[model samples]
Structures are given as C-alpha cells and as structure tokens.
Target chain A: MASKRSNFNRRKSFDAVRAVVNDVRVLVARGLTKSYGDVQALRGADLDVAPGQITALLGRNGAGKTTMISIIAGLLQPDSGSVELGGIDVFSNLDAAAKLTGIAPQETGVYGVLTVRENLEFFANLAGVGRTERASAAAEVADQLGLTELLDRRAGKLSGGEQRRLHTGCALVHRPQLLMLDEPTVGADVATRAQLIESVRSMANEGAAVIYTTHYLNEVEALDADNVIIDAGQVLARGTREELVEEHRLSGLEFTLDAPLDAAEVERLGATNTEGNTYRTTDDRPIGALIADLGSQSEGLLGIESLRPDLETVFLAVTGDRLDEGAS
Target chain B: MDAIRAIVGVQLRIIRRDPWFLVIMFGMPLVIMPLFVDTIGLSLQAEGYGDASGAEQVVPGQVVMFGFMLAGSVGFSVYREHGWNTWDRLRASAAPAPSLLAGFAIPWILIHLLYQVTLLVTGALLVGLRLKGSIIAEFLVLLSYSCCLIAFVLLLTAVFRTINQVNAIVNLGAMVFGGLGGAFVPVDGLPKIAQYLSPFTPSFWAMEGHRAVFLEDGGIADVLPSVGVLLGATVVLAGLAVTRFRVDETKEFFG
Candidate 1:
C-alpha cells in the first residue's frame, strides 16, 4: 500500500512537471464571430488550449461551446476570425489542421453497414493513418474503448452504449494532436462512461490537447480538467478546480459526529445542526481554526469535510444559472 | 484522392447493405421492356430496319431511361449521411467538396453501368434482343451514358438541399428527358419540337449511340461523336457540381 501511494505521488508529480514543461498552445482561436441569421452563435470568442491538458468547456446548452470547437475542428469556418491548430491556420490550411484534430460531436454517427472494426479503420485511414498500421491501431483503440469483443459486429447492430463508444473511438483512432469531444458521455452507460473517461485521461496524459464540453459538472470534476466557464458565446473565466473554488470565496466547516449531540453541545460548538447527524458552522471561517478551538473535542469528529465550493457553485457564480438548463 | 477512395468503399458498402433500390431499378426496366418491344420494333421497322424486333428499340431505350433514375441513388446516399448525423463527421475530415462528390459519383457510375448491362442481358434472355454491331461501341455508349447521368445527378445533389427534392427532380427529369430524347419512340416519330429538344438531353446522345450499334451495325467510329458529347456533358455537369457543393451545408435526407 505504501509503495502504491508513492507510485501515485510520483505519477502526480510527473503530471505537474509535464504540464509546465510542455506549455505549447495546441489550439489558438481568436475573435471567432459567427451569426446564424438572427441567432448569434459566437461573438468574439477566444480560446487557448495547452498541450497535455484537458480543458473542460463548461456551459449550458446555448453557450457556443459546440460552435467554437466546430470551428477549431474545421467543420465550420468562423464568419470572421482566425483559428490555428498546432500553429497551422485551420481555415486557410484545413486539411493540414484536420490531420491534427479529431472531434466527436453531440450526435452519434457511424456507418451502419460497416463492422465496428471497419468503422474504426475507415476514420483512421481518412486522418492519414497508414494502411499497414491501421488494423493494429484499430485493435488497440478497440481494446482501449472496451470494443474488442464487438469488433466484428456491424456498427448498426451494437447496443446504444457500444455504438456511442465506437462513435467516440472513430474520432480518436488516428490519435489527433487535439481532441474535441462534445458531451461524449451524454447517452453513455456507466461502464461506457468510465471507459471513455479512462481513454480520455490516457490521451491527455500522452500530451494531446483535449477540449471536452459538457453540461455535466461531475464530468468536469471527474476529469479534473481546467475549467473554462462559457455563456452567451463568451468565456467568463478559466482556472483549475481549486483556483475556481477559491476564486468564488467559499469557506465553511461541515462535519458529523459519531454520537448524537444535544442542543447545548451544538451551541457550544457554535455549529448548526442542519440535519440529525450533520453539523455546519454558520460562519464561513477557516476549518483549521475551528479544529484548533475544538482541542480535545476533535477526537469526537467521525467525518470532517470543508464546505469548499464545487464546480457547480463556481459555474453558477460565473454564469448566473445552473448547468443543467438546455440551450435557450 | 485517398479520401475519395475511402468514401467510395464506404458508400459502396452502404449501398450494398440497402439493395432494395437496386432491385426496384432493375425490376422496373425489365417490366417496361417487354410491354413496348413489339410496338417499338414495328416503329423501328417503319424507320427502315429490315427485320427488326422491337427488343432492340425497347431494351436499349428502357436501359437508357431507367439508368438515369438509378443515378438518384448516389444523391440519396449522400443525403443519408446527413440523416445519420454523419455529415459533420465527414466534413470534419476536411475532404474538399470535389473529393466527396467524386466518392459518391464513382461508385454510382459503376453501379449504373452494371444496372444497364444487367438489364441488357436480361432483355436478351427474356425478349430475344440480339446484338447487331460492335460490342465495344455498345459498351462505350453504356459507359458514357452512365458517366453522364451520374454527373448530372451529382450536380443536382450539390445544388439541392433535400433528398426529396432531388428525387422529385430526377424522377421527373428521367421521364421527360427520356421522352424528349426519343426513348419512348424514334426521333423521327416525335413532334418537331421534341426532336429539336432531343439533342439537348444526355438520353438523346445515349439512345443515338445505342441505335447506331443495334440498327446501323456501327463501329467505334460511328459511336465516338455520341461518346464525346456525353463526356463533354459529364465534364460540364461535374464542374457545376464542384462549384455548388458546400462542405459545411447541412443536407437533409427527408427534408
């Protein structure tokens, strides 16, 4: 157990050092403005995605996350702006940029007539994967995405989760430099979601820049990605989880005791008995000071956790609304 | 080029999975060939064929006419990608519009040629149609006609927004162009107006080449001019298709 913990520390330290070492911007999009008739999709949006990092583009439905990533992927050209992938202009040199990017849109798409393996290889070949290495690459991707068993099955015949996984797998088969996945876990089952998250983490760990968009705050937390909260076609703010949480200025001490406490004891502790077993400090103060004040009473604490702000709270604080709401 | 080749394989696989359209295209022409064989053969006889069976006129005519409609399958395949929500994924590949168009057109051209050839063979077996001229000339006509029709529908696919619109236009165009080009009867039998308009349709050039082979015992030289016109038409239509196709435009399958 000690060895495993140390190994994890080493890996964590390596990630931190690597994050700083490889600071090149994989995607540089600036002043992206797109107007669809009366509805303005994006208005002067700018995004910079660093290599070896997962940047979660958080928003409700109408926040233009899709529009931004679509332009970066070369699926749509911004009406007026510039986007570069790996330093190549995405619009001026689309095919070159396309060679370096992979995107899984909100919708699931695959060739129904082709087998799962065929679908993977087809996209891989399109993205410049050589014919000699495509088969093994497909196998490797299938294994990574939990699709090895269904490789021979027709894509149309797969279950919903399997198909969704394959849809995402096709996008990354060529192992693009930048991967943009738009809510890849929306319809995914528990196992599929976990498998996808693992795949995405592995990709990011290997130094691919990823822009993952989702309305689910939990996905962003699970990814531990840098958060860019966007709304109404603009980026409100961007930071790491701790930075955003701290930036929101949340501070409180919430805990539970092993034994039930009377009102007299709760008042002495100066904590609110929000529920029968839960206790929360009314004032947002440093938990360390509260713990020091408890002194000998600290031994009685069964479980102690700070009321730090989560991603949802940060999103609400930035966007003035929750993340579950659909596009207005 | 690789993107085009890859799409060609995928599109061919998709078409193979849905063979019902091919069956209908194949069946419709076979049924029509026998119904008009006698009357059209008598019509060809009046136009100075010695002992002509209507099989020659009706079989080649139905082949050219229905082959045009079969070309719609290419448009439908392209639109189906949109319906499947795969259009953006394909566009995201950054394949130029012309490559994507070629991918759909090349496979349908091959299939269109096959559709016409299969009908000709079936007509021979079922209606006693016999070859009279150079088989190479007849093959050239089949090749040129397939190329011309495929290019024509590809242009329409690029310009139109929905599969329904393309279908309505292609189905109507097949019948009207076929009639105007003398697929139903000889150009000599049509009114002066249709004969005047006949030369404007690819069907006219196709039927002319087929008749030269079946009626006049023509060699390659006799059919070369018709092939040239068909190829020229193919190039012009392909140019329009390339100009009109937009990679970013969202096409609707049923819209």
Candidate 2:
C-alpha cells in the first residue's frame, strides 16, 4: 500500500511537470476572419492551444466555434489571417498539417452504412495510418472509449450517445497530435459523459493538444483544463478556471435554510434575490456572518448545498448573457 | 498511392451501397439498348434494308447506344457527388486532387468496360452478330472513348450546382448527338447540315470509331482521326475540370 501510494504521488508529480513543460502552443490562429456573403462567421478571432492540455471553447450557438474548428482542420479557408498547426500553416500546407490534426465534427461525420470498426478503419487510413497498424489502433481506441463490444454494429443503428462515442473513437484512432472535438458530449447520459471526459483526459495525458467546444457548462466543469470563452466571433477571455472566474469578478456560494426562508430573511442574510427559494451572496464577510447567524438561529439545518465558482457564472459576468441562450 | 487507394475505396463503397447506382451502371444497357435497337430494325425492315442478316445492323447500333447511356450515367454520378456533399469531404482529406480525379475516373472506366462486354454478349446471343475487328484493338478504342466522356462529366460536375440542371444538360446533349451522330438512324440519311455538325459531337467520334472496328473494313490506323478528336476533347475537358474545381462549404451552391 505504501509503495502504491508513492507510485501515485510520483505519477501526479510527473503529470504536473509534464503539463507545464508541454505548454508550448501547438495551434495558433490570429485575426482569422471568414465571411459568408454578408454574415461574418469569424470576426478576427484569435486562439492559442497548448500541447498536452484540454482547452474548452465555451460559447453560445453561432459564436463561430465550428467555423474556427473547420479552418483549423483544413476544411474551410479564412478570407484573412492564418491558422498554424505546430508552426506549419494549416491552409497553405494542408498535407503537412493533416498529419497532426483530427476533427470530430458536430454533425457526426461517420458513414452510417459502415460498421463501427469499419468507420474507424476507414478514417484511420485516411489520416495516414498504414494498413498493418489500423486494426490494433482501432481496437485500442475502442477500448479506451468503451466501445469494444459495439465494434461490429452498424453505426447508423447505434444510439445518439453511442454514435458520439464512435465518432470520438474514430478521431482518436490515429493518435493525432491535435484533436478538435466540437460538442463531444452533447446528449450523452451521465455514465457515457464520464467515459468521454476520461477518454479526453487520457489523450491529453499522452501529450495531445485537445480543443473541446461545448455549450454544456457541466462538461466544462467536469474537465480540468484551460478555458477560452468566445462571444460574437471574438475571444472574451482566456485563462485557468480560477483565474477566469476571478478576473470576471463573479462569486459563487450556497446556503441551506432551516425552513423555507422569506425574502426578508434572505435580505437579512445580505444575499441578493435570484429566484424563488434561491439567493446569491457574493460578499465574503456577509456570507460568514450569515453562516454564523444561521447556526445560532437553528442547529438542525436539513441540508447545505456547496457552490463553487464555475464557468457558467464567469461566462454570464463577462458576456452579460445567459449561457443557455443561443445554444442550438 | 495510399491517398489514391483510400479515395477510390471510399467512392466504391458509396457506389456499391446505393442500389439505384448499381441499376444504372449495369441494368440500363441490358434493358434500354434492345428497345432502341428494335426500333432501328423495324425502320430497316420497312425499307427492305438487306439480306437475311438485316438485323446485323442492330448489333453495332446497340454498341453505340450503350456509349450514350454510359456517358450520361457517368456524368450524373459526378453531379450526384456534388449534391451529396461527398466531394467536400474528399477534398478536405489528405488525398491530392490528382488522386481524387483518378479515383472518380477509374470506377466509371470499369463500368464502361462491363457495359461494353455485356453489350457484345447480348448482341451475339440475340441477333447472331459478331464483332468484326480485333478484340484488343476494339477494347483500346472503347477505353479511350470512355476516358474522354468521363472528362466531360467531370467538367459538368465542376460547373453545375443542381443535379436537375446537370441531368437536363447531359440528357439534352445526349439526345441531340444520339439523333444526329448515327446512334439510332444513319447520319447519311440526315440533312447535310446535321451531318456536317455531327463531327463536333463527342458521340460522333465515339460511334464512328466503334463502327470503323465493328461495321466498316477499317484497321486501328484507320480510326486515327476519331481517336485524335477524343484524346483532344479529354485533355481540354480535364484541364477545365482542374481549373474550375473549388470546394467551399459556405457557397450558395450547397443550398
């Protein structure tokens, strides 16, 4: 037990050092602008993704996340600016960049008529995996994504969650240096969502640069990574989780009442009214006093909900818009 | 080479998965050619055309008819690729443009070969007709002719947005040439102006080249002008296809 504990500590330390050592940018886009006639999809958007880390692209719908991923994947070209993968221009040198990048698009790009294994094999070959290595690579990806049993099933016949898993597996089969996944865990159950997040974390641990875009604040919370929040085709802010919430000047805390508290009670606690039976108190000093007073008023509080500063509050504070709005 | 193989493998899988494409590729020649050939035979019989072998003309006529069907079917396949958004995916892959073009061309060439062989067998079984030229020489002529037609289809796919427009355009061109270029009736009986215009049609050279081997007393050397025209057409159309091909997902053409 002691040896195992030491091993775990060693592994954790290695991950910490490796994370910082691999912080060099793997993909960089500057002033990227794309227009479809009059509607500008990207308005000088810029992003830098580092190696061996997950960067969550938090945005509302039509915020140009898909457009950014397309340009980085070499599927679309920007009218101005440039995207580079590992110091190579993606659009100008597609073949070279293709070796490093794999994209799991939002629309599920798998061929429905093919089996799950076949889809993985085909995409692996397209990504330059040799024939001899395809089967073993596919098996490894399937196992990592918990899709080993569904390998022979046709992709079209799978459930939405299963299809999403297969799509991620297909992208991972080549073990690409950069993986761009747009809404990777949308419509997934809790178990499947955990599996997807774990798979992504493992990939990052293997030294891949992963860019994940999702509207689900829970997904962003579940992931341990840097954050880039986009709004109106531009970067609103970017940093670590704590840094972003702090920079945005947003605070989060929760209180449980001995009984259903009235608006007067909530005001006495120095918390602002948010909704029915809910109040938000951002002042640290007032929260401490309220907690002390609550203990004195009642020793039998039925429940206490802990709230931590998270991406959702940071998003609302910075963009001045609700996170759920404009999510398609 | 890997890129080429991957593109071709994906395209072949898509083609095989669609039953309608298989029917058009293999069934159209078997079912449609005989109707046109019978109509030609009825016209010849009414005119007291030839000896006991007056039906022999129907055999060569069916071969040329097969050419027209092959051209239209292959051309429409290219248009369908555009409509289905498969072309956009192919372009985004690591596959080179040359490999993609070769992938599309190779399958159509195979379909053309299958149609030619089926036509020959069906003609012999139904009408007691046999090809007059060397089999190897005729195969070369047919392969060359199909390559030229595939190039034309590639050009149409590059320029046209709607499958309906491409179908209408290819069918209209096919009918004009099939009528005037001697696929149905002899061009000799048409007006002098029509006969003069026939040389410009791709089917005109294709039919003349096939007839030179299967109908007239002509060697491989004798069909040089027709071969030259087909090769020239292939080069120009391929050049246009390469120059005009653009894969942009944001274009209005997607709608």
Q: Docking quality tier of candidate 2?
A: acceptable
Candidate 2 lDDT tens digits, A200-223: 999999989999998887777678
- The best candidate in terms of TM-score: 1
- Residues A120-183, candidate 1: write the lDDT tens digits: 9999988888999999989999999999999999999999999999999999999999999998
lDDT tens per residue, model 2, B22-100: 5654555456555555666566566554322433455555556556556656555555555543454455565665666
The residue-level lDDT of candidate 2 at B48 comes to 59
Scoring only chain A, what TM-score does candidate 1 earn? 0.77
Off by over 4 Å in 1: A1-22, A250-308, A325-328
Instruction: Tell me the fnat of candidate 2.
Output: 0.33
Best by DockQ: 1
Candidate 2 segments exceeding 4 Å error: A1-23, A187-192, A251-308, B32-89, B249-255
Supply candidate 2's per-residue lDDT for A87.
89
Q: Alpha carbon lDDT of residue B115, candidate 1?
A: 90
